[model samples]
Structure formats: structure tokens, C-alpha cells
Target: MKEQLIEKFENDMKKRSYFLRLLLVIDQFFNVLFWNGSQDETISSHVGRRIKSGKANRFEKLLCKFLSKLESEHCKKSLGE
Candidate 1:
């Protein structure tokens, strides 16, 4: 399930406009610094850590938004909401 969510997030991000994609790359750079980590880290780990720490930056927030939206939609479909 986690892998599926991550895959969906990646696909959604790819569908974003070029400008937004550029901004996301910049955000990712800063987030890497804020995380005091390397750029090699996967976004999923970064977002998971930010969610735990309650210090999500723009990129992390965007990821959280995407995940929440997906989960809620999944729930609604399952429950016929």
C-alpha cells in the first residue's frame, strides 16, 4: 500500500506543470538541507520524518496533501461515501 501511494505521488508530480516542477526541485534542495541529509534520500523517507517531527516544509506539505487526498479518495470509494 505504501509503495502504491508513493508510485501515485510520483506519477502525480510528473503531471505537474514545468514551473511547478522547477519549484519542487528547489524545495527539495532546501528540504535536504533542513533535513541535514543527503540528496540521495528518497522523498518518502523525508516526508515521513517531517510528518513525525511536525516541521514539514513546502515540499513535504505538498507530499502530505497528495497522500491525504489519495487516502481519503480511496476510503470514500471503499465506503461508497
Candidate 2:
């Protein structure tokens, strides 16, 4: 069963080009970090300090929430939805 599953995955992957796979991997990471609430973490520690001390935009906060939700949904799907 495990070998069959692996073979199926390999077969599916063979249909995709290397560039496409790279793009997908990049996009998935971007979605999780950019859309997810991790932007604050991405900003250098110093910049993050400034953003925290100073006021952050309302839209930025909204974006954090949006990204968090998307991340959650993606996780749910990956868990075998």
C-alpha cells in the first residue's frame, strides 16, 4: 500500500515540470508567510520593534487576519480533506 501510494504521487509529479514545482513550492511558502500573520516576524527585528511601538495600518492588521485564515484552511486541506 505504501509503495503504491508513493508510486501514485511520483506519477502525478512526473506530469509537472521542475519550474512549475518550484513555483508551486514558492507560492505555498509565500501564501503561508505573506498572507499568514507572520509578516511581523519577517520584518527584521528592528523594524518589527518600530511597527510595534508605532501605529500599524488597519489594513495590515486585516491582512494578517486574512493570511492566518488562509493558512488554517490550507492546513485543513493538507490533513486529508
Supply the global lDDT for candidate 2: 0.49
Off by over 4 Å in 1: 1-14, 38-81
| Cα-based lDDT for every prediction | 0.61, 0.49
TM-scores, all candidates, are: 0.35, 0.39
lDDT of 1: 0.61
Shift of residue 56 alpha carbon in model 2, Å: 20
* TM-score, cand. 1 vs. native: 0.35
Segments in model 2 whose C-alpha atoms lie over 4 Å from true places = 37-81
Error of 2 at 62 (Å): 15
Report the number of the highest-TM-score candidate: 2
Tens-digit lDDT string for candidate 1 (1-81): 999999988897778987977765675676577766556443555666656677767776676667667675331232210
Per-model C-alpha RMSD: 10.4, 10.2
Q: In candidate 1, which residue pairs clash?
A: none
